[model samples]
Structure formats: structure tokens, C-alpha cells
Target: MLRLGCDVRVTDTDNTDKTPDFLAGHGDQNCHIEATTIDPADNPSAEDRNLEDAVAKIKTLDSSDFQLRLIVEGRISRTLSKNELEDKFGKLLVGNDPDEVRRGIREMGDESAPYAEIRGRNWCLRGELQPISDAQKVEGGSRELLIGPMGSYSGDASREVREGVLKKAKKYDRLDAPLIVAVNVLDIRFDRETENSALFGKEQVRYSPNHPEIPAQLVRKPDGVFIQGGHKPRYTRLAGVIFFDGFVPHNPRGSVCLYVNPFGYNTALPQPLYELPHAKGVDGRLNRVEGVDVGFLLDAKSPFKNSGQP
Candidate 1:
């Protein structure tokens, strides 16, 4: 973020009680900074955790013991608790037959959907797993396996962005300076226009792919808070909302990326903050909007640039 035009001076905080994450000054002007992400996936319940652990343990079992690998399907992730999960595993121990274990779970259709597989293990449970169950489960020749943060795209996740911004804004409503919220959209399938609607409260409309100019009337989205009375009384202290998308120019070797925030900036920017050298994000892929400037989208891409053996 230092690479951006918002230059700042580090100042020590004397407050010992409730406060913002940290304080910064752009020249003599200052504000509070809070960082967050745009994730809408519901937290897994204790039952969900048990299912995951059970699947992980099942994956470590000897693959040769069954007629086929212990392919339990991924549908049960959110429903199974430790005891229930143990019962499924115990079914496998009953006869040393893999087919029996597979049959014991379900008929292999409907409620129990195949989520992922590693070696001989599988998981099936009930919960709202995202990217939905229809996402490609087969990778290479391997069973469909989930490897990272799971989610599906649409308006709900974007609403999370709004909720996060408003909540953060409210948290620092009493602060004497402007409040800026930085959101990470790396794991999300973020649509720029959708997020804008969420922020400004516009009915994010869409047209049919078959007819370029044709519009869809019945499915119109309602006005969001920014368009209604939602933003007036609550977001008064919010000075800016910044987005951190992933880096650009993918590669096995590292490559730089750009960050763009379509919204205009805060009113309390410091003179020194404006005076800092502008960052040439992704070698000028991003143009300078009036209030938006270049920024560093690091941390997400930095972890892998090392030898694994250390």
C-alpha cells in the first residue's frame, strides 16, 4: 500500500483501550485503516468439522483393502458429527469389504453427492458447499477433490462486501478521522459491476446472451443501501473503500498485478499522502482515476516464493 499515492507517516498510538487496527498520517492528515475480505461462505458447524476430519482420516487408510476405494461422496460434509462419522468408518471395519462400506452410506445418488477423493477416502454430508456440487470433480485422472476455499458466484457474496464495509464503518464511527476499509477479493469470483451495485445500491440488471440488447424485467435486483436510506446515517465516517484483487499476468515465475477501486477517494487525504510517487500498477495496465491510485497486492502471492524444504 505504500506504493500508492496515499503517502503516510507512522505515528505511535497512546490509547490503551478500544481503537482501530492502526493509525497513519498522510502528511499531517491522518485516518484509521481496517483490513477485511469478501467471503460469504457459512462457517462449518461442529458436525461439519467432524465430517472433514473423518474424510481426512479415511484418506489415509490402505487402498488395497476394498473392492474399490472407499469412495464415500462429498455430499455429507455439513451433516455428519464425529460419532456419526465414526459409525461410517466402523461399517468398513465390519467385514474388511469396501463395497459394504460404500453401500452402507447411501444409494450413491440424491442427498449424497461426490465432493472429493484422495487415495481411498471420500466424504458425504449435508451443508451448503459452494462452487456448488456441479463444479468439475475430476481433475486429471484423479477423483474430484476440493483443495482450497470453496464458494459460488452471484450477488450474495457481493452483499458480504457491503455488510463488511458498513460493519467496519460502524465500528469506527466515533473516530475523529476518516475510516478506510480494504477488502481482499482473491478467493471470490468478484464481478466489478455487481460489487458496485452492492456498494452504491443500484438494481444490477442483466440481459440475455441470446439477444444482445434484450433485457430481463422480472428478475431485476432491488435497490441496495447506497441507493436507498441505508448509507445516509451510517456511513458518515467512512472515507474510502479499497479493493485488493489478485495479482495480474499469471505465471510459474512471479509477475506483478494491478489493483483498482472504482469508487472515488476520501475527503480527508493528507497533502503528503498526495505528494508520494504514483505506483505504475502492472506496468500501466490500470489507468489513474481521479481518486483511485496504484497499490501493492502482495501477501497473497508472497508465500510460495520459497524452497519447501526449509
Candidate 2:
């Protein structure tokens, strides 16, 4: 809240505690601040569960470090079992000498097997593999090894976030004060335009060759989530949403994006918190977005006012 210019103080509450997440400000000016996360597993389908399992298995490898950049095919095999694939991969790491490493692993598997190669003057190692056909996706492979961040939001993934926000928001429905739900859009292919449609109402997703940089905004198409007289967000009780995009959630070094709902339907919307100065033009905190935008904090107030301080 200090990031928003609020003279806020937070307190801890245990699992069985009925108290809200925070007691901001001091003395009589204090207000309740409840927080929750939008977990991907809360509402999962059979496929979602399966995919989650796959990701979990990949994560267990303990040696892979990748994100939006993924390795779906390199050093992979559609025909080898997981163990067999791992064995082949291990061969390529046999020694420090690149020439010896390649020669040593050459006889480890079939000549057609994908292998790892150490390239670049500084030895930028890479897994090399080819694509698999549709038949392979379901039947040809014994097991496949994919290393990367969850890419692209499937239809289910998109709907999940919408449902997730509302579901979490409902927890604070009848609360005395405004509520905020912070979500980590992990492994979610989220588009701002599509999300606005999910929240406000239906909006067409348009594509133009000339404007490829921007997704179709909330254009308010003729037949959308919002009709002639009303908006679509049924759970207007939610006052705002805070988000952390990309791989890790709540990484100590990451930043957050805030969105405030001004609609009256959220009758109890916590204006006090939302109104707290953002450190930016609005509720936006001027910090490094995607945790890597250049020129961040150039002319913006530091969003970490309370960092390293009590």
C-alpha cells in the first residue's frame, strides 16, 4: 500500500483466522485489505491436470532453466521413452571436450537420435531436435521431453482466469470494504483485449497487418459481453485486480500491475486503497514491466518505498 502512497501497515493472520489480510493506515483511518491468489489448479479439466502433470515432471529434472523460451524438440525424441531420452541426453554431457563429447555420445543411440551440441565461441550449448507430426503427438512417441515455460493460453486457460478472478472475488463478496485479488497469470496466454472482454463484456478480436503490435482493444463490437444496456462483470463486488505476469509468482525481485474497477456495481469498492497514489499517473506503479523493460523508472517514482524497511 505504501507503493500506492497509502500510510498502510499490514498484520499477519493465521489459516483459521477470520480477520482480513491487512489493516491499512493508522488508528481510525484503517480499513480491511484482503488478498488471495488465482491458482491454476483451482479449476482444472482432465487435460489441464495432465498438462500440469507434464510440467511438474519437467520441473523435477532440476537441471533445466527456461521460461517463455522453450525447448519442444531439440535433443528430443518422439519414439524414445522418457528414460531412453534422458539417457541419450546424458551422453552429450559426458566430457568437457566438445569433440570428445560428440564422439563419445555418437554410439549411445541411433544415428537419427537428436543430440545436444555445444556451440558458440563461449560454448552456448543447445539441444537439437526436429518437429513431430500430428500422429506423433498422440501415438508415435514413447515419451516426449519438452522444456520451457507454459506458452499461449488455451481456451480453457483464458476462461480459467476469468472464472478464477470471479471465484476469488466472491470470497470477499459481502465484506464491509472493497476487495482486491492478486493473480499470477502463470502459464496463461492472456491478452489484455480478451481479458477486458471477459471482465467487462464481449469485444471482437481483430487482426490487421498494419497494426500487428496491438491486440484488438475493447472495441465494443455490436454483439459483445456488454450488450446495449449493461456490462458483463457480474461480480462487480471486486474493487480491483493486481497481477504478476510471467514465470515465477511473487519473486522477490518482480513487479506488479494494478487495475481498478470504477464501476458502481462494485458498490463497496475500496476507493481509499484504489485512490492511494500509484507512483504513476494512475494506480500503475512505474516499475520494470515484464521485469525487463528498458528505461524503466526513468521519470517514475520508485514503487519500492517500503522495500527493506519496516
Q: Which digits, one per residue and each the tens of the lDDT, describe model 2 over residues 203-260? A: 4566777978877553544322212244343455555565545424123333355555
RMSD of each: 11.6, 12.5
TM-score of each: 0.44, 0.45
lDDT of 1 by residue, 1-310 (tens): 4534354443325544256665666556776677665553454335346545755654443323221223333323344344553445434333344343345444643334222222223433322112212233333234422233232222234555566666766664456776666666543446555455556565545668899787665332444423335333235456556555543333322222222222324446444333322222245243433332233233334455463734
Off by over 4 Å in 2: 9-14, 17-19, 26-31, 39-45, 50-156, 188-191, 194-198, 205-233, 246-255, 265-310
TM-score of predicted model 2?
0.45
Against the true structure, candidate 1 reaches a TM-score of: 0.44
lDDT of 2 at 76: 22
The ten-residue window of minimal lDDT in model 1 covers 126-135
What is the lDDT for 141 in model 1?
33
